[model samples]
Every structure is written in C-alpha cells, then in structure tokens.
Target chain A: MSAMTHEEVRELLAAHVMELLLPEERASVVAHLAGCAECAREVESLRATSAELALAAPDRSFDARRCNGVRSRLLARTAADRDARARLAAGQLPEREPLSLRPPHATAPESAGGWRTASMVLAASVAGLILFGGSILVQSRRELAQARESESQRQRLIAGLIGPGVRLIELAPTERRPGSARMFWNQTLGAWTFLAYDLAIPAEGRTYQIWLITPDDRRISAGIFTPSADGNAIATTTYALAADSLTAVAVTEEPAGGVDAPSGDIVLLGAAR
Target chain B: MIADVRSPDDADALVTRVAGGDEHALGVLYDRWSPLVFSVCVHILGDDDEAEEAVEETFWQAWRQAERYDVTRGAVATWLTTIARSRALDRLRASRRRQEETMSHLSETKRAAVDATTRRGDDPARSAEVAERRVLVRQALLALPLEQREVLELAYFRGLSQTEIAEHTGQPLGTVKTRVRLAMEKLRDRLGILRERDA
Candidate 1:
C-alpha cells in the first residue's frame, strides 16, 4: 500500500481507536503507526480515552447468585483443562476406567495376548479400584465439609437477627401495592434479614428487588427474590456501609434476573430508623 | 480472595498470577472488574441474557490470553473493558444479522422497546475511587458539544463506522470524521488525569 500522508493518518487515529475505521483504512493506520512515532503516541492516548467511555455506561445490578454460578462454571472449566494438561504431561490417557474394572454383568473381552498383557490389565484394574475408593472417600469428606459450612452460615444468620445492635425497620406497602415487610439490619455485623408478607406474586418473568437508598439518594442493590405462592418471601444479604449513610429502603418489581436500577413502581418503602 | 482495597499494581500482579494458572487470582480479578464489564456489555447489547453471555466470554478470553496482556498499553481495567466492548459488539452484530434474516418484519419501534428494557442505576457498592472516576468521566462526556458527543457515542456504543454514522445521521462523510477526531481529542484533554494515572 502507498504511504498515507501524516495528516491523513492523524485524521484516522480517533476512528481507529474507536474501532470505527473500515478494514482497509484500519490496515493503513496500523501500517502508518509502525513507521510514525507521533501518530503512534496519539493513537495510544486516544485509545485510553476511548476506553474510559465504558465508565459512562450505567452500572447494572447483577444477581449475586447468578454471578456466583458463572464464576463456579468458569473455575470448573479451567480446573478441568488444568487436570487434562497434567495428565497428558504425565503420559496418562484421559480419565476413564479400565475395561477389566467393568461391572461383572458386562461381558469381558477374551485374552488377546500372553502374560504381559494379562499382567498389565491386572495392574490397571488394581489402580482403578484404588482410585475409585479414594474418590469416594474424598467425595464424602467434601459433603461433610459443605454441610458444616451450611450450618455455620445458618448460625451466623440467626445470630445477626437476635444479637445486640440489630435495628428493626418496618416497611409499609405503597399505595399501589399490598404488602408489608420488615428489615433486621445489624449494622455491627453488616447483615440484613428481610421478610415480606402479602406481596402479590410478580408477573411472569419478573421478581422483587430490594434497594438501599443512601442519604444522597444513591440506590444500591441489596438482593433479588421472588415471593412464595402464598405471598411471602425472605432474603438475607450482607453489605458494609456506615449506618448513618443509609437513609431508606425500598422494593420494586424488576425483570426476572433484576435490573441495575429501579425502573419499576415502588412496591414497598421504609425509612431507616 | 477479593481484597477490600486494590491498586493498579495489585491488578497487574493478579494478571501475572492468572497468566501462571492461578485460579484464585482470576477469581479476584473477576470480582473486581465484572460489574464494569457487565455494564458495558448491557449498554451495547441491551439484552441481559446476551450481555451476561458476553461477560462470560470476555473473562474467558482474558483467562486464555492472560499471558499476552501488555501493561504498557493500558491498565488492567481498561484492557478488560476493551475486551468486553468487543465481545458485546460481536454479539450485537451477530444478533442483528439473525434478526434481519428471521424477523425482517420487526418494526423499529419494537426493536426500540427491547432497548428500553435496559434500566440504569448507580452501584454505590463500588469502590469510592471507581465511583469518583465514573463521575469525572461522565462530567467530561456531558461537557462535550452535542454533535461531537453524538458521533462518539454512535461509534463507540453502536459500533458504527464513520461512513455508516454519516449515513445514519445524514451528515457528510468528512463531517463525521472531523466530529470523531474532535470529540476524541477533547475527551483526551478532559480526561488527562486518567491518562497520567494509567501511565
């Protein structure tokens, strides 16, 4: 390609940083940057400015539960990849039981070779058996640990509800809705236990989201939950903020996964006392 | 584990660990940056499901390409946001293609209704430094002339080429290019502190 003039290259730098240049123009800009110091510096600075545009987008409140699910899946996939690489490096095939360890009801292939093959198959079976037993023990231990963690979480929640420094905030239904709720905010523990009753079931593909309004009127997502068929729901979450900074609490009906901001009508409202 | 306080150095260290196959470091990075990434995706895609999918793809790409990250190019947050915007735009373009083929009859009003479903709210839970930076960036964007800001928004968020933006806005191609250049330079000037800090 013929060399573009300095003026032409500089004009395209902004568009290039925004990824808005046509393919040919982008190629020309890339080529020019390789040979032009000034254009390269300008492009880098413009690119950094372009990136800051992302901050202009409003924050969307993601469902914490859903976020956790995504993180878990990501970690699992990475772990699986790591294990496969390790196994490959160690000269082992992917995880699978030896044929000799198949259930007794399954048919076994006839011995196709002599004592060497037989000895290897025997050794494989023994190794598979040991691995299977080890996995079972590990699984049991993991389950026990999980159970203990769950119990401990429950204990913490109970303590937060009944412990000293817990303040009760009574939520009254707005004129447009029919529900009453209460919040047990333990500022010292940074725990919140919310319980609502007589709330109408949200429309299909909708759920109730709780928001903590700061004194400055900034709304922060506490959590999202759906009421039971009998018009009752409970949710617990932890947030760390100065007690005096919170001014009010409100609930709104939002899309199934909830929204980053309150766009729906307020269903219940309460002032932090 | 997610730390209560994070600096640019900490973020760089996290990326290095991620490059070395540290899953915990990856998790901390995800926790620290996913909200901003998700927000960008939602702004571009305007659909939660697609945006969520884009977030997953962005971080997964980050995980696979961690070793290629260049701190000299920009900060970690900026790098992640760049990846996020690219992923979201890819999804947006693909979905538009599908819509053109299967839902050609869909009216512009109906399409707009879908976009309207995305709501906006501040995440006060974010670090004070991030929130302050957000305020500063927003102020700079708002201070731009309407025409200049319009061109930048169309190109950045809507992923429109200069020629396409000219067509969309019924302006001349040269005018569109000029507007983009002016807007970016002004933004660079207004957000100079960010540039210095990233340096």
Candidate 2:
C-alpha cells in the first residue's frame, strides 16, 4: 500500500480498530496511530465502543450444564497449556516443534501430541517429586498431592540455597521446643529454604506452617510440611517478597494444608532484619 | 465454585491469578464471561460447534496470553471479547473461503442458511447489571442509522474487511469506510453519555 497522509489514515481508524485492515494497511495505520495523538484517542474511543458490542446480544439463557461443560474444557485446556509450557521450559518436549507460543494476535492449535505430551510431562514431574521425597513445584489443585509435592520442593529449595546469593536469617529457639531453625533465602531468585533443627514432628493430622510477615503485617502462608521420623524437617518454597517488604519469618504448628493466618502456637520466630 | 456475581475488581484479580498459572482463577474467569464470549462467537460464526470451538480457543488464548493483557487498553471482559471476536472471524473466514470454492455447486442463500441458533435459549446474564447493560447495548446498536449499522455489523460480526464489506454491499470502499467511521463516532458519543450518567 502507498503511504497515506494522516487524514487518509484517519478514515481507516474505525476499520483498524476493528482489526479489518490487511497486514500492510494495518502496519500503515499503526504507524500513523503512533505519532498522532488525535488518531490514537479516536482509536481508543472506537475500541471502547466496539467492546460494548459484547453487551448487544439478546439475553442469553443460562445453562448450568453447558457452562459446566465449557468450564471443564477450559480448565483442561489451561492445564494442558501450563504443562506444555513447563515441558518446553524443561527441554523435555521436542524443541523443533515447541508448543505454540504465538503472540496474542496470532494463535494456532496445539499439535496432536500436545495433550499427550503434557500428561507425560506431568507424570514425569510427579515421579521426580516422589524420588525427591514428594516435594514438587506443581499447580495441581489436589491438596493432598500438593502437600506431598511441597515437601520435596522444600528439599530442592534448601539445596539451591548454597548455590548463589543466599541470606541466612536465624530463628531463635522457642521455649516450648528446644529446636532451632534457620531460613536461607536467595534474594535474587526469591527462593526460601527453612531448616528446622530438632523440631518435634506433629501427629499425622498436623503439620508445621511457615509464615512470611509483610511490612503491612500481613502473614502469608509459605508452606506446610511435617518433620521426618527423625524430628528434622526442611521446607523450600518460592516467595517473591523483597527484603524490605518482608517483616519477619515465623513457623507455627497448624493443621495440614496450612491456614489463612497464623492460628497456632509459634514454634520459631525469625527476625528478617 | 465460581460466584454468581463478580465485580470489576474480581475480574482483574482473577486475571492476575491466571497470569500466575492458577487454573482455578482461569475457571472462574471462564464461568464469569463464557456467556458473553459465546454470544460473540455465535453471532459471528452462526454455528454452534464453531462457536464452541471459538470459546475454547478464546479462553485457551487468554491463558497463554494473560500476561500481555493491558488494563489500559480495556477491562478483562473487553480483552476476552476482542480475542473471541478475532478467533470467531478466523473460523468464519475459513468457512467463507470453503463455501466460495464450493460456490460452483452451492447457492449463497443455502450457505447462509447454516445453523444460526445459539447454544442456549435464554439470556445468561446472572446479574442485573449485566442484563441491564445488555439492554442498553442493544438499544445503542439499534439507535444507529440503518446504513451505518449494516456496515458495522458486517465489519464486526461478519468479520468483513472494509473492502470485503464494500464488495458485499455493492458500495464503494470510501462509502463503506465512511459508514463504519460514522457508526463508531455515534456509538462512542452515545456510550460516553451513558457512562457519565451511570457514574
């Protein structure tokens, strides 16, 4: 397409907003839109107007079953998407035909092996978790499996601490427990390794909860884990709180799956300063 | 379970969680907007199966591209609708090409007679605000001049480019562009006024 003046391109602004411009025409209009504030506002206004079309449909009847079907399909697709990304990141999938990582404007269907590959990756990840003592970084919704996977993940975090810029925060031994704990954090990677020394293992139904105190006094659950038969437990988790925003780190005994807040006896309190 | 009502803040929060790879948040977002997304698809594809596929593709794309979603561009619903519209058009355009190739054997009227029924019989607006907004939106579209509305629908719902719309309507390309621009200008003014009133 030949170069068009600003006025000429403005005529196509509506169509451009609707994404009706062919690629070259789109490129021209996009170029014009960049330097022309007036044209850009027009485009935004047109876009807002177009978005309202979503409301223009007739009252659609509610179908719980249909909604559920779509929900399940979306959930499965999302899971598959995450698995594919994880596999690609892990170099487990074929590099030549990586999962489609197209930009938002361009998307393609997953290859036939996409879901099968995802399942394989997930199984492998879970197997790896088991071999590492059942702690793994997984996005699965199964709480029991997640709890088990978290344990092995904790071990990995502890192992990763010695590699780089790791900061160790000491947890003074509490009166009720004679055990001492140390929290090792890799500030750059935002990984935490909690080592509880001589901490007593809770009964089968209970676990130790690690908490991160934000400057705003908000306590976020880091993870939940039980000590081994030897009364020593290590937990590792990815926490993104910066050193300044993190007020302190603490561990408390709580029921499995952790809680919204620290609701149990504090076994160890570590000053993050 | 996804709640029956979700505020705008809820939509933003769900998207944030989705960006963090939270499948449950994605599910909640899907449940919240599936009707609107499906409606856009059905209106464009005019076929249940293709529309269903578009819905799946839209959410799947949303999952993959959640991080790219810019709130400054529009809300979560707007972002999802835009994606749905694009996907539906892709399907519609492919079917259109296939029909054109078979045009030697099939009539245009027959081709246009493909199943246009939506998957559901009733409006799926679970909240009063959504239902009211739908009524206002329909009114706004209806308020547009017939000529403008015709080109707007062709460009938007039918996924026709300006040139294609010109060809379809037997109008000059300039005329088609003018109609689309006029339509958007009117809708923009009208919706702006409505928003101010609501505010």
Which 10-residue span in candidate 1 chain A carries the lowest summed lDDT?
A115-124
Candidate number of the best DockQ = 1
How many clashes does each candidate structure show, in the order listed?
1, 11
Model 1, position B35: C-alpha lDDT score: 84
lDDT of residue A241 for candidate 1? 59
Per-residue C-alpha lDDT of model 1 across residues A2-35, encoded as one tens digit per residue: 7789999999999898988888888999998999
Give each prediction's DockQ, rounded to 2 decimals: 0.33, 0.27
lDDT of 2 by residue, B162-184 (tens): 89778776899989988988888
How well does candidate 2 score on lDDT at residue A235? 58
Q: What does candidate 2's lDDT look like per residue over A1-273, in tens digits?
A: 788898889888878888878899899998888899888877777777787666564444425644554554455445545655676688554322112211122223223222100100112223222213223333333542345544334234433354335687889756765777778776544556676667777877787788777666767767776665545555565555556767787888888766766789888898877
Which candidate's lDDT is highest? 1
lDDT of each: 0.67, 0.64
Q: Lowest summed-lDDT stretch of 10 residues in model 1 chain B?
A: B101-110
Lowest lDDT 10-mer window, candidate 2 chain A? Answer: A114-123
